[model samples]
Target chain A: MGMTIAEKILARASGKSKVEPGDYVVGKIDLAMVHDLTGPLTLNVLKEIGYDRPWDPRKIVIILDHQVPANSTVTASLHQQLREYANKYGTNFHDVGRQGVCHQILAESYVKPGMLVVGADSHTCTLGALGSFATGIGSTEMASVFLTGELWFRVPETIRFELKGTLKQGVSAKDIILYIIGKMGVDGALYCATEFTGEGVERLSIDSRLTICNMAIEMGGKTGIVNPDAKTLEYTKCDSCEILRSDKDAEYQRTIEVVLEDLVPQVSLPHSVDNVKPVSEVEGIEVDQVFIGSCTNGRLEDLEAAAKILHGRKVKEGTRLIVIPASPSVYIEAERRGYIKTFIEAGSVVCNPNCGPCLGGHMGILADGEVCVSTSNRNFIGRMGSPKSKVYLVSPETAAATAVEGKLTDPLKYVRS
Target chain B: MSAIKGKVWLFGDNIDTDVILPGKYLVLTDPNELAKHALEGLVQDFYKKISKGDIIVAGKNFGCGSSREHAPLALKYAGVGAVVAESFSRIFFRNSINIGLPAVISKGARGIIKENEHISIHLDEGYILRENGEKLPIERYPDFLLEILKDGGLLQNLKRKFARRGEV
Candidate 1:
């Protein structure tokens, strides 16, 4: 009869002693985030409703990421609107140079354990890696949250992913998630909370855990979470915060066993995130571009992993490589560590800290008939550009390897050798 | 809620937000302008083909990617009466309801409905009626969500709440 971590969090937030799945409750929000693309729309709703100010400005975060530096006049105007709103309301705002992907910014500083967080971007679920109950909401719903400082929820059932065994070399968190997504189609986890636990989770770094949780939405999860442990505490720099974990007898709708040793470098084929396969099965397919960035895989560790592969090699002449750090802090750290230099020397353009090309909004959009190997989540049609183009989702290791060969080459060859 | 009648536009599984409205168009706040690009990732000029009061009938997991309200707004502005899928991504379902667009879940929607077929949905009655008079059950909204829908959307509902509080 013990409640899962998700139930406990919702219970605490809703001021209830217990909450079961399918039970509707209105929960107080701890953090609410909005980004450039969705922020403008949310602000427009507030404008329409004649709501003058947010209920709690300090708890609200406004970040500019998706179309940073103003892709066009329209985007620039949108940025202006968000800035004015933030300045007027005294909300915590991250502007152009200070901004990163909203989720990355939240992970780097704001997210903490046992909190309820909501953001207007789908990848807001990324912060659930830190053990908070974070999920994505639409702009309109976010506007409501901004006004009332609360939102309604139907407590979702939990699906515990029992990860076992250590991941082999050249395979990583991305591979494990891709393997799971392939098994559980896109809707496999629809409306359910995904709790990642077990030995393999302990083996993963916070970055890797974030990568895993970042793709929860791709598999239709309401949120993906990892119980806070030593590594999570270290990453969040919270030595004394209360850590949330599922009880031993916590009720889960189902338990899925993900054996890490069985995983290889995995890739999601074009037009669908669940159309996954081992890199070897689709090897040697030509690629025109390689992108190693986005909220999903643009961390410093991702940069280092890709840089290690491209250290002494040039990108294939016909292939274009673009490396973007997820946040400014990550960018500075990567630069200080020489990963930026390695990427640049390897013929890849090291871009600014923003959501470059992941949303197909800027920087590295693909032309028609182009094929790209990217580390970002979601490979839906036209995700990176032309509907005729294709995207294969992989880890930073596989992306760099593919950049070197100008095709879908497995990373084991590069890393093992 | 009154009954809504619309022609069906059938689609397959996992029709993501990108196919509903690509990221490049996210900057546009105008729903009509967004409607111009609706489903263009799946079909060219799809909006032009949609008549007013048409409904989107699809297989599992329609609206599966992104938290863009523009997706549902585009469909609604393109004159889509409702979207009845086997299932929907969570955020998309919320976005649809928040924007006054109806997102229904009918397990047999795709099986019983054909493209361009006229169908009527009785939201209050919790069923879809095919032209052949086949009654398909649909998931009904909870009372609180129904209140939001009755007020036209979350925005209007908030407006009313603000007026009630004299906070507007």
Candidate 2:
């Protein structure tokens, strides 16, 4: 049988001629990462496994994100513990402020084509945008990889999404993903590898592609992969890595064709990423906070989209807005572009990226009964703060417009200009 | 590998890890501490109501968000004998086996079993015998995964490896 990109990647890593769905293979790891939230536990598991150091320290990257600058004494100690371990093992370490978000750091620097990347963070699948077979692993699994440098896989079946059409104004990769999720509930692609194909996918900028692939986890997918093109090579800086592609006659569990023009700016309402509605129906719902950040939508372009709307306008009275760039470099670029200044002048709090308020990790946490419109992914109950508080997931444009009106507002008006 | 019987608690589809164990309690570092909040987001007072040996029969994609092993650990400590969902998120499925918790899948279990209905499971046999004496699809452990559960968990499973390495 012809192979899909994911199957091809797995087959190569496992040193096999080919692997099919449901077939088990023990694959070698090219890279593994852990951040502050899971780093301490992952390293602890390595010790329990009786490993003095990682199998290959050079291949491991450790970053202190999640509760960075340490939220409490315990978290501070956690960061300190990770720092000591990284120093001892001589693994690549990006201590607080050196790196912004863990996944963002990998995207900007390390992730390359045709590699297998495993991370302790669920959003690790974000790296698949560059054509690598990246997915999340728990601390225990990560430790096993640390010891033997190989982890097993079930060789998930691939679901191809062939995107076609030109996106209308205000519709972006985020809208297309949300639209797909809405159609394919949370479990639509359970344990499946989703590959983006066709011209529309190739047309997406790296930032937008990151937004689409980052939320693959929300659909219960193992990973969302986009084939490598010139844009991918330009981003990863690799001369050539075998850009794996699905054979035309390759079998998939199913294939979805997404017509980009049919999509609109979308929102995921309270408590579920798949609980989506068009912005027209959700407009005017009062909001208490508006945040634009995370590994999902915290890139320079995301910040620029929000800045374009907030440039001369002050944030509405009694409403709050917070902007966070996904990486320190993105922060510098946004600053250079005056997006940061416009955000501050518009009365929004710009925070150093550390997954602020996205996982309820800290910074701008919601109080009881408050509702937030955010660009970050996931709106599970208490995902922001109080279980009673609510979150609506949107693109940066929608989040910025919501901040201005103190309610969920459509982004098309701002996008047209 | 043996037969185990329990009363079941029914849950619906897309029950994510956040709802199983909220992100707030992630720092607890103790499975028992995390257990108190299991399913609290979906079924308030879950810890208080649940008894040992109770089963969680859920719809598709149970335990889907965040690769937190705590989600399975929480359910295990909360006294769930096994989770017989329509399907499970892969991370949660792996974590359950690594932690010695049995996560079973049965396509017909959801519609057949009611909350508080008694059912028995056979891990090696791969079937859930319902109250009516009807056999339904249950989680069947493959040889490799059965090894993880047989050794009692990944920790024990790994400890044996280190011991064998020493002999080498």
Candidate 3:
């Protein structure tokens, strides 16, 4: 039977000639990942399972990007445990200040097209941008992967997102995804594979495609994918000449058509990614914080977009803005482009390359009753800080404008002519 | 074996793993510490209010997020007798099973479960008794999973199995 790129990759990886959605198959994992927070727990689970050594040390990666610099003694202990675990197990460790976030670092160093990657973090689906079938698993499953280097998966039904028309200036891939979430609602893509295609998607850069697929979880998708094209190959540095694409007769659970021209800078209102509204509709809603980071949109392009708006303008007083580069490499790139200087000059706090305020652990957490506009994926209650601290999801451009205006303002209105 | 009985609390769709155990507390190694934050966001004072052997019934996609085993660990530690959802996230479902937490996917469960209604789960019988004494049939868990739960978790179950086989 004909299949999409995702189906074909899963089938090949699972050692099956043909596999359809809903078929439970166990497959060898090409890449496995764990971050600082969960790595220790997974290692403990591995010990409990009586696996003294990792199945393949080279295939395992440990990233210390969350709670970088060790926020507290507990976090310090976690990092120390990860270091020991990596050293003892012979797994590759990207210590804090060396690599960026786990998702970005994995995409940069290891993820390849058509490979099956699993991580202990949910956003590991970010690797799907490179045409890989990447999904997140729990610590115990990760421990299993550490021991046996294999995982079980049910081929999820695919949802095709066909994009058309060119995106308007200042409207980014983040806006397009937000617009999709708004239309589909939070649970529309639940437990399904989301595959991006069409002309609009083709126009997006590799980083942009990663942004789109990274937020798949916000809509409850198991994983998201963009077919491996030149952009994916270039970003992934993969020389595998076997380019994967969806078959013409491939079946899909659902197909959605998004015209880029019909889209605008969108925002997911407080409480849910699907609670979306156009920037114009929510104009003037006050915001106390603006965050521009996470695995979703912390790339150089994302920083450049925000810097373009923050140039020569200071963040509004009483509005705290925090920017985190997704990876150390992206941080360097942003510095080379002077985005960091621009942000700093504009009074924005440039945080280290960690998932700091996005998960509400440390660094720029929102206060009670406060509202924040963020470039991160989810807007669930208590996501940014206190349960009462509302989070609004938007593009980096919108976050920048909100940081400057101290309110929900259309980024288009603030884009310099 | 004693039957686990509980009252069911119904929730809506897309109840993510983050809502179960907020990402901030994921670093905590102890299940009890994680349990304190279980459902703290969805229902304030959930840990304080939830009693031993209470069940959580939801529409779909229960426990969807980073496959941190802590989510189920927190729920299990918080005294969630079992989780009956229309569907479960892949990782969450597996983690639930590995941790010996009873997770069943029940069709038409949304209609039968009411918040604060008494229900008795008969694991051996593959059914739950509603407050009105109606028998709600459920999918029977695999024998291996039942044995694991009976042993309290995968670790203990593995220990027992290995010991019985004299492989240790």
Question: What DockQ results do all the predictions give, each relative to the true complex?
Answer: 0.92, 0.57, 0.53
- For model 2, how does the per-residue alpha-carbon lDDT over B87-108 read when each residue is reduced to its tens digit? 9987888888888888888886
Instruction: Flag the better candidate by DockQ, 1 or 2.
Output: 1
lDDT of 2 at A342: 96
What TM-score would each prediction reach against the true structure? 0.99, 0.97, 0.95
Candidate 2 has an lDDT of 0.87
Q: Candidate 2: where are CA atoms >4 Å away?
A: none
- Candidate lDDT scores, in order, read 0.92, 0.87, 0.84
Query: Chain B TM-score for each model?
Result: 0.97, 0.94, 0.92
Best by TM-score: 1
Q: How well is each residue in A113-194 modelled by candidate 1, as lDDT tens digits?
A: 8889999999888998999999999999999999889999999999999999998988888999999999999999999999
Residue-by-residue lDDT tens digits, candidate 2, A344-396: 99999998877888878789889999999988889998888888999999989
Badly placed stretches (over 4 Å) of model 3 are B1-3, B122-126, B139-168
- Tens digits of lDDT, candidate 3, A173-267: 99988988888876678778899998788789988988999988777788889888888888888785466678989999989899998888898
lDDT of 3 by residue, B80-129 (tens): 99898887876788789878788887778877789999887787888878
